[model samples]
Target chain A: MRVLGVDPGLTRCGVGVVEGVAGRPLRMVGVGVVRTPADADVADRLVLIERGIEQWLDEHRPEYVAVERVFSQHNVRTVMGTAQASAVAMLCAARRGLPVALHTPSEVKAAVTGSGRADKAQVGAMVTRLLRLDAPPRPADAADALALAICHIWRAPATNRLQELAAAHRRTPTPVRIPKGTR
Target chain B: MRVLGVDPGLTRCGVGVVEGVAGRPLRMVGVGVVRTPADADVADRLVLIERGIEQWLDEHRPEYVAVERVFSQHNVRTVMGTAQASAVAMLCAARRGLPVALHTPSEVKAAVTGSGRADKAQVGAMVTRLLRLDAPPRPADAADALALAICHIWRAPATNRLQELAAAHRRTPTPVRIPKGTR
Candidate 1:
């Protein structure tokens, strides 16, 4: 399966596309970065992001999309902006009817670097080694996007289990089944 | 001075370019919207935003950029993404040596609607009325961007005062003259 991984941000976003299934060596399809100016207005930046995604989708057409879940601490301003950015990504995925998976930072780090707390540099290094790249992906965002794809592959089985459980729950009979004449 | 206002988001971003000086009515030079699919990857979305901003800047060459200062809430996931989007905008503006300003949501709302608690629709309506638009800007995001520009104009005097105070604080006192043999 072709999987596209994204590191979403307002200013700069990193994207990596990989083609393969879980537990198998994935082939790199493409990698790139998108940047917005500090001076550009928010609306313009968002428009740029949308257009870029459209172009990437048109070019790669990946089957699944994986995005890093937003994580914020005490910075309220930062958190709010991040949320808006995340919404854009989710909206994009939903609009296309593509299944989207959100991975936590720790999960991505653990899957890629065998450590949940791995820093950006460490994650980049591991991604390079895993992908057998001649050089590390420029800009930490791109490498993180690749790691996110790797994380999705590692977590896919669990995701399936969760989905199955949800489905089973839905299939379970309601506690109060009424007769046809019942009010 | 030319000011670009942005209402940043993941799916749609509103951009407005206005020109005016202190005590002068701001004239709308241009306005447009950029949209992205909800299902596109985050990286691609950001790339689209960057390119869109670059295109607008190249075309319009605004001297200043103003964006809404995002405020975070309970949605950690969404906030992170917005922060990234804001960063992209800031970077874009900084690259061109264009001064950037951020206004709070309440400030923008109050400036546009005369009420800080106004909803998007209300704010949008007021923006249309204020700008003398034939219709409300499509997708709502555009209207919000225009409102942000209006806010910046309303608040510019206060910002100028702050700058003056800061400048005064930085002025060094004249060096004391030392008599040749007084000591």
Candidate 2:
């Protein structure tokens, strides 16, 4: 399966696409960074992000999307911005009817570098090593994005059997409870 | 002087411009929302934000720009987004040689509602009341943007004077001391 991984940011976003399947090595399809002009307004910056993602999606047409989930909650303003960016990613995948998998930063690092606390430089090195590239990915964001894709490939289940079991449980009927007063 | 206030986001950004001098009643010169398609990429979203800000600057020629400073410590992803968005605003102002001011969320809310802990609804209500508007601004982001302008107007002296002092300090030379070990 082809997977599109995204590292979302307002000014710069890193996107990577990789093709692979279970028990198979993943191959990099494309990787790039989207940059917003420093002088642009917030509105324009957001537009830049959207256009970049669209271009990437059109070129790759990946079957699955893997995005980093927002886990920090320190600054309200920061949290709001992240929420908006995450919402955009979700909307993009949902619009295309592509299944999305959200991965935590630690999980991604752990899968790629064998350590949950791997720094950006370490992660980048590991990605370069794993991809067997001559150099590390330019723009740390892109490397992180690639790592995210590799992470999902390593961790996500091949089949939706677990999901099906959960869904079946959810679909099971519940017996009505009689209120004490009514009884 | 005209001051433009911005509340940056990935999906929607709120922008407002107020025309007046310090201590004078500011009039709303322009206000609007810039939106990005949910399915679009991050780069495209940023472009939209830039275009919206550029359009507003071209139309209004505001002398100064004010933006909210994002300060998230927990969520790295969210913090990165906010930092990117904030960088865009700063760059826009710098490009036009307009001085930019950043206010914290609590500071803006405190200035608008006399309470740092004010909620969005409370801040919105207070902004409407302060502006003598018949209805509250639609989409909380817009109201917050307007509030940021109001805060800048009311607290301009504090910020301006501090900036002046900092500039003066930078210009003044300090005595250099040689370390005893070096000597």
Lowest summed lDDT across 10 adjacent residues in model 2 chain B is found at: B78-87
lDDT of 2 by residue, B1-183 (tens): 678899977677888887776666667777788887866545455556667878888998988899888776445654555554555555566667788888999999999888999999999898788777778888998888889888888889888999799889878989899888996
Best by lDDT: 2
- Worst 10-residue lDDT window for candidate 1 chain B reads B73-82
Compose the digit string of candidate 1's lDDT tens values, residues B11-68. 7778888777657666777888767677755656766776687788899998778876
Q: In terms of docking quality, how is candidate 1 classified?
A: incorrect
- How do the predictions measure up, each by TM-score? 0.56, 0.55
Candidate 1: regions farther than 4 A off: A171-176, A179-183, B1-69, B73-105, B108-183
- Which residue segments of model 2 deviate by more than 4 Å? A1-183, B71-87, B118-134, B174-183
Best by DockQ: 1
